[model samples]
Target: MKKIVLATSLLLLTVCSAQAQIASAYAGRLQSVLDSVGKRFHIKGLSAAVYRPGEGMWTGAYGESYSGVPITTDMYFPIGSNTKTYTSCIMLKLQEAGTLSLDDTIGKWLQNIPNVSGQITIRQMLNHTSGLFSYTNDPGFFTALNSDYTKVWQPEDMLQFIGAPDFAPGTSWEYSNTNYLLAGLIIKKIFNEPYDVTVRRMILDPQGFTNTIIYPAEKRGTIPHGWTVMTTNGPLEDMMVSANYDNTAFLSMATSAGAIVATAEDVAKFWVALMNGKIINSNSLAEMKQFVSINANNGYGLGLFRMRPVNGHVVYGHGGTCFGYLNENMVDSTNGITIAVLTNQDSIDNNQIFNWVVTALHKNTLQMAPLSIAGNEKADDIKIYPNPASNYVDVNLGTANNAKFELIDMTGRNIINTTVDGNYVRVSLSDITPGLYLARLSNTEKGILKTTKLQVVH
Candidate 1:
């Protein structure tokens, strides 16, 4: 019996090694996907990573961080609201240790902040149900933030910008940085140390996430120069180019709400580890996954959001933005594959680019071309007949079962969403307006079967 068990263990290790080796072979193509998407979007710098459970991880970077310097896989980017995941995890861990209860009202640990009541529960804060006003939305806060780029803001100082509560606590849901700001203060108060120190002790150090750190408070190494639009209709300006544009004040103000700097690879690994019971226990994870329905296709859990990119495929993750950076991390529920995409420029939609990267990574066959402008290249598994169709279009789902079809416009709006079976399916375009649309086929088993550009004509 012992010999059989040993042999089985050896066999499993061999299979995992082979799978990782196969995944590594796609490195060049993955790199191409980043390069193509980054250039198309005019991103100053971009970094992306993919983590498969049995297969090893892959990371890629593109474009220049500065005029002459290039973005590398090792460079850090502020993972804006993604920091909320860490903050939420800390609160859950504290509950597990009997340090605090989620049901406890904020009034117990904190008191007397204008517009914020003590009646808000810890769970409400973690899940953005507190109805607290988002301090960042206050025009005064922006004025102060712009007034002094070098000034490090205390959590309370930020709270002063809060005008009034959006609604009564637990009455409705609204995304507010103020909720997390108070949560960070509570963590600091409970641990008798800085909030980031608790984060380091609880999550970062245990996972060997050496590259990730709370920014401004911790010295950050040289990172890709991040860019942002300074005015409403302004061009992208490098945040690192001058002290006036420095990210220090913004990051400091972000605090626990959105102030962690780390590589795309580390961000991807963090998600996979959290979901697999490394950061928290199984029960805690289950609690985290208890989602509140936000819409037909999306839901919000504790710190994470359910992303139903297509029919039947759900990924749990978060997206974030800092002064000059936009980042997104998603882990596939079905396959346990994690993907993180980071870009320096804040103007473009990182989700559209992330969806393209996901489709590129899960190609059933290697014969497909690199990811390009939607609708130009066809995948080997699926084929869309006729270049332009006025009333109907036929899709051939080669070797794909239980697939769902989705048509999205250029603005990322869903035009048609439905499920289909068999090898051949016809979609009606009679209602669709004349223009370009991206037709995507996906299922639970395979993340993205195919994404092609389709043109609708009258």
Candidate 2:
């Protein structure tokens, strides 16, 4: 406990010193605001951790991990939907290994998955375009969630919603747990192993992430964490949620789906690992990043969520939920900011905190990409094919070489950074989340600047 407290205090000092160029009051108030958040939310024993770039690491616990005992920074939490992004990563890793194809139809891997069309590609499932039924919406989902919800759920057991199709694949997008469940099944079939094992082998083990978990049903008695009690009318109760359960129940999410646990720090590390080409083969991981539409979380990609704006830069991550708990986590890998929050509360302040933390972090983040076109060169030449692409994009520089190209979105952060050595440079824009982005190219030596639109519609 002394070591942990010392480490946390050092992180605070680091953040303060690193941000000295900015201001101390800014840092102090930011920390204060987090505590205020705990108080405002009636947050009991809540924990918040951040990994700021070029500064001190910050992690502190308030309230308790539960009402009875003290919660520390080292303790683990479910991290909810944050697990989905990892699930998506495993699928991409499999594709890179030639065990699966992003374009593979659902019927190709799982049994009795009624194919609305033979086009329900793995890409669509990860991007939530498969239009499958969201198992969370099933009343039976909640009914089972409360009583003996710890039973081990095989992939097929979770896929019982295959009786009808919600919409034609890729016609419209809807978040469906069935998609992830199928993804998990596909992983199992491809790797001849359990989904949890495959994910750890691919993402967790490679990155050395130790705090997250995928609850297994058989280990019910050992579960950690709590839930906030709330009625449909929303009353605050000093109750810990179902922290203990059979960890195996998490398997129901399938290998390619949403069953994993992690700390805010691990979430940050994984985002950076994925961005820095440390998780899987660079080419395949890039494919996983291609963004997709998820109306609920603003937008989605292969398996990520484009959460919000930070220093006018886009942030990426995912939020999650299970029976009695709500979880939300986010990361802006480019700028090195990560936020993870776990709650036993029946509901959470995902939107408010997302904005608050982003605002605080944005104020301290350096080199916030400026989205200015007033004086910049207007680019009319050069074209990049497959704008909303799933896997890759082809850039035609039109005789221009040795230039830098940037794929910038509304937040002004360039999602893709590449240098042109030939007339055409094919960049992998997948693996990242999906959304609208602009392609900017500049030859500072030649004093030439060109901008174009690039979309990855995978």
What total of clashing residue pairs does each candidate reach?
Answer: 1, 49
Per-model RMSD to reference: 14.5, 10.1
C-alpha root-mean-square deviation, candidate 2:
10.1
Measured on C-alpha atoms, candidate 2 has an lDDT of 0.57
lDDT of 2 by residue, 230-255 (tens): 44543444334433443345435432
Q: Write the per-residue lDDT of candidate 1 for residues 1-458, one digit (tens) a residue.
A: 00000000000000011112224556666666666656554557777787654435777777767666777788898889999999999999999999999899999999998888999999899888888989888888878987988888877788788778899887787888898899999998998998788999999999999989897888767667766655566555666774357677888898989889999889988997897578998678878877777887777778888877632346788888776677887775544567887876665554654565544554321333333222322357578767588899888876655566878665344567677777778888888899988787765444456777888998
Relative to the unseen true structure, what is the C-alpha lDDT of residue 87 in candidate 2, on a scale of 0 to 100?
Answer: 77
lDDT per prediction?
A: 0.73, 0.57
Error of 2 at 396 (Å): 25
Q: In model 2, which runs have C-alpha deviations exceeding 4 angstroms?
A: 1-30, 114-118, 217-224, 238-256, 294-297, 308-311, 356-416, 419-458
